[model samples]
Target chain A: MGLIGGSYAKALRRLGVKKIIGVDTDGKVLRQAQEQAVIDEALCGAGPGLQAADVVICSVYPASTLDFVKSAVPFLKSDVLITDATGIKGSLPEDVQRLLTGRMEFIAGHPMAGRQGSGLGMSQAEIFDGANYIVVPAAFNSSGAIEWLSSFAGAIGCGQVVQVDAVEHDRIIAYTSNLPHALAVALINSASYNENTKYFIAGSFRDGTRVADINPYLWSDLFLANRENVLQELAAFSQQLERWREALTVADAQALQEMMREAAVKRKDLY
Target chain B: MGLIGGSYAKALRRLGVKKIIGVDTDGKVLRQAQEQAVIDEALCGAGPGLQAADVVICSVYPASTLDFVKSAVPFLKSDVLITDATGIKGSLPEDVQRLLTGRMEFIAGHPMAGRQGSGLGMSQAEIFDGANYIVVPAAFNSSGAIEWLSSFAGAIGCGQVVQVDAVEHDRIIAYTSNLPHALAVALINSASYNENTKYFIAGSFRDGTRVADINPYLWSDLFLANRENVLQELAAFSQQLERWREALTVADAQALQEMMREAAVKRKDLY
Candidate 1:
């Protein structure tokens, strides 16, 4: 089981979800989750139990999420509600909804909770505590499905459950999540790779670059999936940096101080 | 009483220093430090007590540090050891050494410790605990003076006392300290200034941009004083970020992953 899936299973189990079934390609991971009581049953693929379930939550990579949903469509019960925990939604929700038609409902969800480390061993139910959960509801989705997902999120200890359209979700996430990760990676790479340089790193450098220690495969997929938004945000950040660079180059103390002061005041308001 | 000076006084008091005479322009701040037992005596300006002191540590702004040191030159005893806690060296150490040639010794020091908040109210002796203490030894400095400073650093609870030349110290700090602060400010300003955007900021965003809430006047002086080094580091960082932008633009998943993975591995080593 992956970190997000395992965490979901643990949270669901704590909420007394009856007979939770985990699906994973890796048998060893599935067995580990079962042994840890994160899941009651482990299935390599969709089975008869899938058709009997009232709700199915798919936690998979963004690249494979659409395919996973498509494959699971035939095995779902007529009244079953389906949701996904993918980072980038794009048009996947619309595509999945089109495929399901009148058979099932699909609401796209993203749990803005993660650890630098991954895998079943790193999963904890408390990871969701004080975290933000976003639910992207398409025009075709029913209000009842949205309400149910909101209640589920609250029960799992999510501090906030924000409802927004898929387009807005991707746009905001590009700024709040993807852009920061990109900056962290860039900051880390910018440093000269030497033991001497490592010795001098202090608290700010460590905290500022923490996200650089990322799951590359997962992040790359997420970045490419939301390519347009990420690029736009990246360009905006670069332009912001360029303004500071200009001030520094010209030795404009007043301009530099004003910019830093404004940022400081704004940042203080956020916290 | 400023944060760094007040913290040093607090730590020195705990170490049973016989007396710590604090010189400040503001009488209220000096009184506050005196009332807090952070200093044994507080003066509005240079007094007879300053000349009587065996050692003096100038904790003032970089622009004012040289002037402060110069003003104290006449009051100091021939054997008195002089040092400063200035953010930027920028030939200040050389100038001060030249001014006090054969009369006193000036060793530049930087305490790698700070809080987002300022003033004596936020000062704690424990701020120095497990923090780095860098001593920039000048060519004119004696081994005995360096040894004395090292012991002083250890007594104040500095986890490590690193010895380096002034040039090396400034060069490394440009990358380790100044660049991170610059990036943080730029990152904070990069976000669209809106209430909705503020609400979406999470842990990584908060941590990555914490230093953006900076003392602008202090930072501006530091940046300008170390303009050449800061600009060089900033340029290097921009080049590094540009490489990532290129990789992302072409959708080079493998290259992106490799960059992230390398940064992650290197960052892991630091902790």
Candidate 2:
């Protein structure tokens, strides 16, 4: 019904959306979602059973996004504005746009925030507080749908609304999200030693690699689906690494100091 | 004084080693350190300017550690066990052992604990709480000096005293400290955007590259002095980055997934 789909079902219903239904393949999660009174109805399949709602928001793994969209295409209201809450976008937006083919307005949305811990239990109406809601528009998008999506993003308490194409969104996220995650994974990999050696590590090590502890299954899907852009960013990163190596290899203290100085100054400017 | 000379001064005075004197070049810092009453007396110069003591500890940057030791060799108490508090060992130990030849015992010491903040303001008697202190001995080192250094590390609350050679200490630190710092700098340098872009950056960006906000003067010296070992580790990291790039290039979902899985498992093992 709204951004996270299930958790805000009651709130959306109170706000007078006609009917609320939660569709999840996992029976346990579906029952738990309903038992929480977050949704008025629950269903297992994404077929005609989900057709009555004025809008539909899908939140699932990036790898299965297209498959889910294809399955739900026929059942949606003909004029329904379909949206998604996936991390990456390239394949899903293209596939969904083709499958629906102007029958419904397909708008892509991503809430640019989440915590270390996430799931149905951790879901909240306030989760989008002060967050930015990114609106990604595909080729078949209507400007009216964009305005409504922006309003939805605002109603959910998103502090900012950004507009970008799916391709551009994926590319920028490759630097902002994927690259940082990969770096964290690499840093933590080097610290897997015997217990004694690990005990000597400090808060800096713990804080530096905390992202490595995220759920692996979701991350693997996100990484592979965003592979092209992630790789491009990694190539840029490798060249940056080489510059550091060159500065270190020749014992060029001044050059190394300058680079580090610039980095420190730029970083402090973020304050 | 303690493991790194100043801690030894604080501990020895508490142990009734009367008239403790500190030696350092920074007059302002030394004056501040003295005002804190961590040391009974403070000398902001080389050893010839100070009165004789029961023991002398040299705590200086790694590159100048040997020079400081050589300067102190001629003026220490005849039986004084001269030790150091430098991070790396390979070249510094050799230089000290060569210079002090037979006149005094040169036992290299490293206190593995440190505060995120540096200098006298952050110094404390409990600075080495539950920390590992390594006592490195070269071929010509005296056994009595090693025993004395171990006791010194213990006096400063170094939880464990590990005995090692200079080469081993440097090798391990190449991976643990220097390489990690280089990686942080490289990651920070990968982007050239200004403060606006960084403002939208969440915890992941800050956490991944926080170490880039280090003292450039000190780090430049460290990277230059440990050039060879840092280069070797950088090469290894570059190879890993290349492997990740290859996985992305062919859209090899399985390879990328396996890489993430292996890294995740390895990282999880550290906890």
Candidate 3:
């Protein structure tokens, strides 16, 4: 398991779940999980380990998440409920709806919490503490299924459980999650960086670009999967940047002060 | 005295300086700082209080820094070593040099450290712990003065003391400091923000936009003071942002991942 999956496994273990069957391509992580008691068993990929699972939490990249569901559907109990911790929900709800058979159900979710690093070593049961969990309920999903997923999120320490449609979820995520990552990447890759930059980096530079140290494969897939919304949010943000450029170019002190004041008020209000 | 000035006062007190004199327009803050023993004495303005000082630290906005130095120049202590905590060094070195009386020295410095909020209420001596201290040496400054300022920064808990000229300081800070603050303000004021968006602010959004809760009066002047360099860095940042937009539009996952990987490497290298 990776960061998200391993964390779910760890948090579930802390909850004293009857059994946690961890799966990962890395044999060492699985073995470590078993030895550390974070999991009772370990599997290399989706297999019979999922057969006894009443509820499966798919914590993988968007495409791999769908792939895992398709592979595990055959082995899972007919009435098992499934939810995901994918970064993007674009096209997932419809794809899952078409792939499902019998009584299987899939709810899409996005956890609004993450650390800079990845892998099981960075995983923590408390990562979800005071985090926002966005649950995307599709047309076929029942209230009962949604409630189960919501309560599960709450038990795992998510402070806010927000319900929104898949489209809205992607849109909000493009602004809140994906846009920030994209900007962080762009900032870290900017041409202004030079040899002496290391000595100049402070909290603003450090915090603003912390997510630039991202897992490329996962983020590449997520960004492409939700390309349009990301571009749209980028355009909105570009417009905002242009406001700053214009204000600076003209040396309009009053305009600059007013804009900064508005942003300060908005930022303070967000909390 | 605001956050920076008050913090220096607190830090100097922690260092057991013989006397700590604070000045501010806000009478309430002056009284609070005096009663808290953070400053041994408080003055409403740069009047007689600066007459006895061996070193004067002007922690005000860029323009106000010049004004304060000019106003305090008329006071005694002709041998005073003046340094500032201004965000931008554009035009400051020459301006201070032109304003200096006989035997006075001004060494422009920036503390590559800050926290959210301002005012003496938020001041802390340990804020500079392990922070980088940038000392911008003007033509008029002597090596002895720079050494004294560097050691003072060390005594206040800066981990790294770097030296750069005023113009270079502005250029580097445009990237390290100004660009980040501008980006943060723009992100917070983006059009996508709606009433429900508050539920989505997580570590990425929160950390990325943390500086948006800034001091408008201070930042607006700083941004304009370093307008050319700030604009140049913004252009560089915009170009990088356009790379993301183009890659996403063309569905170029390979390019996207490659750029992200490079950013990850660069970000990791910064440490």
Candidate 4:
């Protein structure tokens, strides 16, 4: 059992995946992971780090994931189960499957938990506690592959296992993650560089704009890759903003109150 | 000395005001204040609370702060300085000046620091720590009143103190607090909410919508009371959201990235 991956390697080791092989492009990160005992064995190579492994999980960058999967296809043991921790699924599943010459099964998976501060040092095994694990398995994928993927997530203490079609997975994430990222980025940009303006910021501004500190390079690729669904979600958000603007324009106190009251009640009910 | 008059009470106590009396409409709150030693004596009655008060400071709700000031004006001792802790300064300052037909001087003040959860339970002598205390003294106000108000805020541990006009204070708050609150409420209301849809919500959704749980009644009054400036700020925010929509519409990756990048920088740099 080789846990050659990113931050999730730390979690896997904590879950009793003893023979973990840590892999990263960054030498500093590999050493840090070793110091933190996030991985038992460390490996960094031009090829995928999973050699003679029963199961191989890739937790690489979102853009390079499918490419990594393709490069690693020849090195994996015959009939080895491969999975990912990428946010999007549709394209990766198709591309990796085609690249593998019909030998390996790629199960697209996402752990619905991450801290803003990325990399292994910040990774914690407890991040999976009460978090959702979404699996987007292709149609031709084996039930064995799906079961193993679920078990992998469960072993790391994911609270719930969710399965959705590849297309649906991408669409939901376009709305859930991509669109919110865009909004945060836009809102933060509008403020620009103003020294005098920040003094008045309270907890709401801090909390609401927390995600704006994300790596834009990663987000830009994800947004463009999942373009259609993200565009739809963005339009929906605009429509909502317009409704709010209309209420504010007419000084419709009652409408504003109703909107806020409904949201307050519903939001208060959420964990 | 009256602690309820304004934030000056804390400072006055630190300056050895001796025999500080706390007055609030809530009897339980008054008793709690007394029990906690926030005041030397806690008076539930307005008449009894005003007795021998060398300085009267009003820290009431923004809308009715004027009425509170006027009602207490008659009982105030000669040469007693009047100040306030209301966020809005324009209306209150005028009312305080008009209603107080005595030798007492009126100075408007606002302490710009508070927790999300307000009221006496979260209140403390340390609430003013590292907070800005704005002293909006009236045009006819004597230097003595202004100095006393500054001393009051300083005594309460407010690190930064400044003076501004009533209109300026209201406009600034309308931009800072009211605009942000309205934007947050609108965003949360616009999100897709259903039993199944919520299953996909991650940290982004929870953090983005946390402020939606705020009290609508309190905020409704706040927005409506500061209708002019809040409406102006709402227009500015609407324009910003429109820019975001336009960027999304064209799938302008560079534009979106720039926006997000700026926002990220501003959020990160915010002190």
DockQ of each: 0.68, 0.32, 0.88, 0.45
Report the C-alpha displacement of residue B76, candidate 3, in angstroms.
2.2
Which segments of model 2 are wrong by more than 4 Å? Answer: A1-23, A30-57, A69-83, A91-106, A111-163, A187-209, A213-216, B1-22, B34-40, B47-57, B73-83, B97-105, B111-135, B140-163, B191-196
Best by DockQ: 3
lDDT of 2 by residue, A200-239 (tens): 3443465566676565667777877788788878888888
Instruction: Kindly report which residue pairs in candidate 1 clash with one another.
Output: none
The runs of at least 3 residues in candidate 4 whose Cα sits more than 4 Å from the true structure, single-residue gaps closed, are A1-6, A35-37, A46-49, A101-103, A117-129, A141-144, A191-193, B1-22, B26-45, B54-57, B115-133, B137-163
Candidate 3: lDDT of A102?
88
Give the best candidate by TM-score: 3
CA lDDT of every candidate: 0.83, 0.70, 0.87, 0.69
Model 1 agreement with the true structure over A1-271: per-residue lDDT tens digits: 6888889989998889888889999999988888878888888876665776788888888777778777777888888899988878899998888878455899888778887867888888888887888889999889999998988889998877888899988998888888888888888788554666655666778777888888898988998888888888888888887887888899999988998888888888875
- Give the Å shift of residue B209 in candidate 2: 1.2
Taking chain B only, the TM-score of every model is 0.95, 0.83, 0.96, 0.84
Please give each candidate's TM-score: 0.94, 0.77, 0.97, 0.85
Arrange candidates, best DockQ first: 3, 1, 4, 2
Better of 3 and 4 by DockQ: 3
Candidate 2 clashes between residue pairs 3 or more apart in a chain or in different chains: B1-B8, B1-B9, B2-B8
- Clashing residue pair totals per candidate (backbone < 3 A): 0, 3, 0, 6
Give the range where candidate 1 chain B is weakest over 10 consecutive residues by summed lDDT: B191-200
Residue B183 error, candidate 1, Å: 1.2
TM-score (0 to 1) for chain A, all models? Answer: 0.95, 0.85, 0.97, 0.90
